[model samples]
Target: MSENGAALLDEVEAFHRRFNVFPLEAAYVAVALWDAHAHLVDAFDSTPRIAFLSPEPGSGKSRALEVMETLVPNRMMAANATANAMFRAVSATETRPTILFDEVDAIFGPLAGGDEQLRAFINAGHRRGASTWRCVGDGSSQTPTEFPSFCAVAMAGLGSLPDTILTRSVIVRMRRRAPNEVIEPWRKRLNEPEGHALRDRLAKWAASVREQVDGAFPEMPEGVSDRPADVWEPLLAVADAAGGHWPARARVACVELVKAAKQSDKASIGIKLLTDLRLIFNGAERMPTAHILVSLNSLDDSPWADIGGKPLDARALAKRLGEYVTADNDPIKARNIKTGDGVVKGYYASDLHDAWTRYCPPLPESPLLPLPPLPRRSDPVDR
Candidate 1:
């Protein structure tokens, strides 16, 4: 704990500042700690993905990873890579590789049709000892094989990542540099060596404190708990190890950046369905399955009415709602309603109560301002 400074971290931050224009100072600090953390990832239970995302192109997202490339161990720069190749690369050696995946949106975006295998790999890889079992060899002789997926990954891409991965990431929202804020044009040959020098220094510093950082519990800032806590613990440890301004700075950065991320987070379809169901249920204690479908399909803003040129069917409605579990850990299901004719499937408001409370914020009240008195009618006009 030096009184002077987090010298190495400051240097790393400066290095990033040279090329990329991050939207916030906290992002710069986070990225610097992330660079150092990558070298010591083995000491932690989970490694947070450093995601550089933007809504449009030329936002320097890839350049951010490019600068990061020189500061991490066994850096593997990949774009549009297959799941098999990536998993093989991760398990190639005794040491985990720092994968800097550029253009990752391709794997998750709509045009690519989604790669579930790769998404699963990225998600599982956040935690240590996460392995994917595959059938090796050929034909009848093939045997199940285990592949380790845990590694440090930095991703740069346009658009948002899936919520699962986004939760595991320390997101740095990159944007096009303003005209007045200038940065050095990055040329790998010349600038890379300096970054490598810093990288070497960071690795040495990390090695010295690997034992201390392992299983260390760094106190989190307020409102930081659960998954966010897990994601910041490693980076905070690295900052605490550096001492000086970092410990305080890191906490501030963690709180602010995390606050920003949560505020901007996109609600998942499961949460959305829970909200819509609450609105559709209205005041009734129960509603028939067919009644629910009609209400869901009638919403003009929702896609249910024209799903594949047909209204949402009962099966799809059930499937979508089934994605969530109740507070009692039961899958949400429509119970049977006994009518004059026979038993028919229907949903009970009580069944959805827990889900609505947990998933949706309090429903906003309508202002109901007095309609402006109908504009006084203008005495039926001059005609």
Candidate 2:
């Protein structure tokens, strides 16, 4: 690594240190470098979106995006913009600006109606050569215009975004700062010059390394694959270009962040349920629904306890599992089995095994530690 490159990375780390970001240090640094190199995204096949998400307010999501706006090239800070406006803004200039979108939940949340066009634009913009066609001019003279949809985008908001957007993003889950954590307060008048100085230095470095970055393919860490790899490729390339501790740090961040995303991805709820069921099954040939519910509820970290505002009851469990099973071929079957007491409905291991292979993430060799034994109920007293 060049002395300049090492120094630049150090500066990037320092810049990130000014904030109380919840992600690991490497993630913050990677994001800093990504903002510096945002202009070169067109040279690559994919440009990953930076998504700062939190379940509730006051998690520093907006503050992080504000910091990014100061350092990225031709930054555009938008509280909200129409899809057409965004498309035109991106296509209007040869040097596309970095888009910092705040309160993204307002634009993409469940109650936000009829934003399909904007959502499509964001999704398509992740890859180069993607465009959205729109009709322009007066009714008599209208023509189809293709708008370029490639640029570095950072979005911050409450709750998770749609799966389509999240899959194309480097997700940073933020949290409120602890009482002991500290960071320098960010004030635009005081910090703008410093941020600008770093931005200029980054531009110079990026200009000198554009060709290398365009062709770069840093080896992905183990367990990173598919869309996650695509989303992280540019950040890893930037790290490789600015060598020192970065390459190692970037890999660690990639693995850890991607793992976190997978665990929290609401789209994977089915997969999670399937995997947990597999663990509950263990080596048993068959298990009753009541037994399965007990095991699931007993799990300390599983979402079963409070899924849909209620514990995982027999009906809910059957309803969820039913989505994976159909009449054609049942992967999970409920059959009446004669037990010591009477005939009862239960699931067979063979049926669940097929579901596990098809729907769940691969499990570790050892099953999750069995749920702690339920507290025994005291015998009723005569009184």
Candidate 3:
């Protein structure tokens, strides 16, 4: 925590605030600090993916990524990269570059037409030394070649990415700026020099403390654990090395952002389904699959109706729900229910209790003691 390092962090935050309106001031600062720490990617065991997601267009998602590209070292912006092109670009650089993929929904969305290889690459790249193998050359001389996938990745798009990617990321939910929220317009002519100056300072500072950052293990905030702790470790380490208010600021960001992600579970279809099912159950002991489907579809706002362009039927419902219930490792289990008509597949209240408790938001607290019953209103009605 040198004076120089602390001052650099402040500059980075100032630079970040100049262009974007982040929902949390800490998130904006964390993002800027991450760009500075991008140079130290190889020093850590896992590199956190920075995901900028918005519900709709015009949310400053792309602009935030653009600002990031200007600050991160050895950065590349690939808005229109094909799967092969993206792989090739990563393989082209021995020292991995900071890769920015704007409008990433096209590659991972439902209409993506099976880019599993690309998806696998991105997922594996979160950890150091992870690679993807592919066949090279003609059929007769084809040989398996390993492409290093480890890199600092930032993706900006509408909605969420797959669960795998999101779990490995520091998720930032973006929104359209309100009229009162003002930011300096980003212009290459005006901002480029300032951004470059900050980038250079960050690189110099990171180099000075590279050894300390490489082995530093900063304590994580309470409630942050496992994958999230892995993702935020490097950022927290950077903050610790930087001194100033960053260490505190970084922890605040970690706890707040992680809690927000857990509460929403926006990127996990299974978790989201579990939460919705909790509402549908309404403390029922058991529910037949048919009834569940009816209830799910009847909800005016649920995605069940549009889950693949058609209402979720019994088969689709079973398929989606099966992942959480049937898996041997899953805590929740869907059980068979015997009825007067016949034996029907369904979920028992006991089975879903664990899932609901773990995945759903806690119910609002009830009053310690029920208030006395209201006096009879018959006289008032007559009046």
Candidate with top TM-score is 3
Which 10 residues in a row give candidate 3 its minimum summed lDDT?
A: 325-334
Ranking by TM-score: 3, 1, 2
Measured on C-alpha atoms, candidate 2 has an lDDT of: 0.81
> Which regions of candidate 1 fall more than 4 Å away from where they truly are?
1-5, 265-267, 273-318, 326-330, 333-348, 361-383
Question: Which pairs clash (backbone N, Cα, C closer than 3 Å) in model 2?
Answer: none
- Compose the digit string of candidate 3's lDDT tens values, residues 1-383: 53388788888788888898898866876797688779788778989999999889999999898888878888888776766766677786565678899999887767776468778878998888888788889978999988888888999988789889989998889999999999999998889888888888888888888998997789999978899999999999999888888889889988888877786646677877777788888888899988988888888866887887898887776677666642335645456899999898888877777666765678879836888667686635433
Count steric clashes of candidate 2: 0
Tens digit of per-residue lDDT, candidate 1, span 1-383:
42222888888898999898999999999999999999888899999998998889999998999899999998999888888888888886576689999998887764568889999999999999999888889789999888899999999988888889999999988889889989999998999999999888888888888888989999999889999998999999999988989999999999998988865624255666667778898878988999888888888766678755788889888888787667787888889998888999998887788889887767878745675444457656445
RMSD of each: 4.9, 6.1, 2.9
Candidate 2 Cα misplacement greater than 4 A, ranges: 1-3, 265-267, 276-355, 368-383
lDDT of 1 at 184: 96
Q: What's the candidate order when arranged by decreasing lDDT?
A: 1, 3, 2
Error of 3 at 17 (Å): 1.2
Off by over 4 Å in 3: 1-3, 92-94, 326-336, 361-372, 377-383
Question: Where is the poorest 10-residue window by lDDT in model 2?
Answer: 325-334
Please provide, for model 2 over 218-315, each residue's C-alpha lDDT reduced to its tens digit, 9 standing for 90 to 100.
79999798999999888888888888887888889888888878878464667788888888987888889999999999999788998756789988
